[model samples]
Structures are given as C-alpha cells and as structure tokens.
Target: MEQNDGLWQALDAMAGEATEYFQKARLLQERMAGITGTAVTDDGYIKVTWRDGGIDGLEINPRAMRMGSADLAETILRLSHEARADSRRQSDAVMSDLFGTQNPAGIVADKEGLQESIDMMRDVFTGAIGDSKDLIDRLQRRLRQD
Candidate 1:
C-alpha cells in the first residue's frame, strides 16, 4: 500500500511538470505569433515588414522611383531579405526566452528539443509503471508467505 502511494505521488509530480512545460510552450506560441519584423533600405527608400515568416507589408518612398528599374528592384529584394532576417532574429529572441537558448534556426530545432523532453517524460512514466508492477509482485509474494 505504501509503495502504491509512492508510485502515485511520483506519477502525479511528473504529470504536473509536463503540464507546466505545455503551458510554457503555448505561451511562447502566442508571443511568437504576435512578433513582427521591419526593415528599411539604407537610403530609406524601401521598407518592408515580415510577419509569420512572410512579407506582410511594404512601403516604397516616392524617391525610390527616381532610380533605374534595375536598381529599384535590387533595393526591394535586398530589403525583403533584410526583413526576413529581422523576422528570424525576433523568432530567435522568443525561442531564447522560452528555452533559455538562442539559435537562429528558429522553431524547427526547438520542436525537436520539445520532442526530446516529451520522450524523457515518457521514459519516466514507463519506469514508474515498471516500479509499480515490481511493487505489486513483491506485495503479492509477502501475502502468499503469510
């Protein structure tokens, strides 16, 4: 009976820890969704905003038209790249806040880390189940001896 109680306590504690991790993950998702990144050309003729990993807004100053079409296209493309980079930086910041580590690869790598944590928890639960089975077997043996 004492062993069963201890096993239940351990399982409850693990469940609580898993719940906390899931809550933190959800909060991080909300924060990342709200993040936006903006960039402007060096000459301030082109501006772009990135959200959810794509260009969400753009602004081209009237002065930008004075440049040759090729130059204007190049500037816009460069600004777009810069905006995407800015978005990556923002995502990394959010990931760092959630995971205590910063990497530019963004959420893909973090998902792997999250999976690993879940795997660890699964192992813990598996071990707990094995321990419970062993305890039950021991108790049955004692009962048989009596």
Candidate 2:
C-alpha cells in the first residue's frame, strides 16, 4: 500500500537525521574535551588553568604575597571564579550551538514526545549555574578569612 511505503520513507528520513545529530554531538564533545585555557586576574597576581572538568594548574605571582594574606587569597579566589565562569559560559555556548534552540531529539525526532528530555537538560544547566555560583561564593568567603 502507498500508506505503508510512505511510513517507511518517513521513518528512514528520521533515522538519518538522528544519526547526523548524534555524530555531530559526538564530534563537538570530543573537540571540547581537549580544549585547555587559562585566565588571569586584573592585578596580574593570579592565574588559573583549567581543562575538561577540573583545575589543571595555578600560578600565584610574588606580587600578590606583598598584599598580605587576605588580599592574596582574595585575588586567587577571584581569578579562579573568573576562570570557572568563563569555562562554563563557553561550554554552554557550545552546547547551545550544537543542539540549537529546538533539540533534535525532541522536536525533530518525535515532535514533542521528548519534551521531557529537553526540559531535563534545561534544568541541568540551571542547576549547574546555581551550583557554580554557590561554589564561587564559598571560595570567596573562605579566602576572605585569610
């Protein structure tokens, strides 16, 4: 029947799209994994390097030591926060660019049947930002005690 043929064609098209989406996402993930970078504070006393999900390196200039313990700590904390925020922002941008505003697995594949999956990702990013901010605040507070 023509209806049966049409159904198969539609399914085939969807399968192809899904495959492309996954391949692209995987490529982006791999590209992101090896990207390492550093950020420096305005005072030139603190620098932080990070890759993937953790701190890769840290450098504290001798100039910061002259600022006393508290100032030195604050400078380091601020630089760390800046580096983390910058990394997260970049990661989010990459995800957004790769997935687009409408998630391929959601709207493109099943026409809203996967809305929950999309919602879950949004929650994940929201929670990540909240957690990152909390962590930065904690670090700042702890450093201020020095």
Candidate 3:
C-alpha cells in the first residue's frame, strides 16, 4: 500500500542519516588518534610530547646537565604536567570540532549527570513494573471472584 511504501521510505532515510553520522564519528576518531600535544620548559631545556593520554616523547637539552639532579627532575615533572594540560586542551578542541560542542568530554566525565540518568531510568522501570504487578493482581482477584 502507499502508506507502507511511505513508511519504508521514512525508515530508509533514517537509516541513511544514522550511517552518515556513524561515518563522521569514525573519521573524527581517526583524526583524534593522530592528535598530539607538546610543551617545552621556559628555558627550552626540557621538551615533552603527549599523545593518547600518555607521554609520547621527551627531550632534554645539553644545557639541562648544568642543573643538579633534583632540579632536573623537578623541571621534567613540570614540563610533563604542562604537556598533559596541552594534550587535554587539544582533545577538547577536537571533541568540539567533531560534535559542535565543547562539553562532550565534560559531559562524559560528569559523574553527577551519569548518576542522574541511571537513577531516572531505574525509576521509570520500577514504576512500570509496579503498575504491571498491580494490574496482574487485580486480574487475578477478578478471575477468582468469577
């Protein structure tokens, strides 16, 4: 029937949209995988690169040898933290570019929102099940009276 044909057409269009969205997501993921962030100490004695949530590369200038071991270690740690912050900023940019929002990662990271969603779903299911149970009990009582 014509109505059936229209329904099929609508379903096909929805499927095509879903496929396009998934393809874009895949491409964005690939691009994000290639992203890297780098930072260097103020004196340029230490450089660090962060990728995929970990340190990918580190370089120490020969001038760094003039410093004591403790100083050198402290500098390295500071540079590493800077590099990690840079990486997080870059990742946020990528997420914004792909999703047209800057808070997708924040939303995913938000335990409050996640917990609220879970609680809402649980409440809905519990209410539905309770209603079904009440209906079943009434049906059983009516059948017994019959």
- Cα RMSDs of all predictions? 4.1, 22.1, 7.9
- Pick the lDDT winner: 1
Backbone clashes in candidate 3 total 0
What's the lDDT for all of these models?
0.82, 0.71, 0.78
Over 1-146, each residue of candidate 2 has an lDDT whose tens digit, in order, gives 45445555655786897798889889777867866656897766778976777778898877767788887777667766777777777776676678777544336568455777679768855665666666678789989998
Model 1: residues >4 Å from true position, as ranges?
Answer: 1-6, 101-122, 135-146
Residues 1-82, model 3: lDDT tens digits: 4544555565578589678778768877898898888889888878999898888999998988999999988888888888
Backbone clash total, candidate 2 = 0
Q: Model 3: clashing residue pairs? A: none
Predicted model with the maximum TM-score: 1
Error of 1 at 53 (Å): 1.8
RMSD, candidate 2, Å: 22.1
Q: How many Å off is the CA of 36 in candidate 1?
A: 0.9
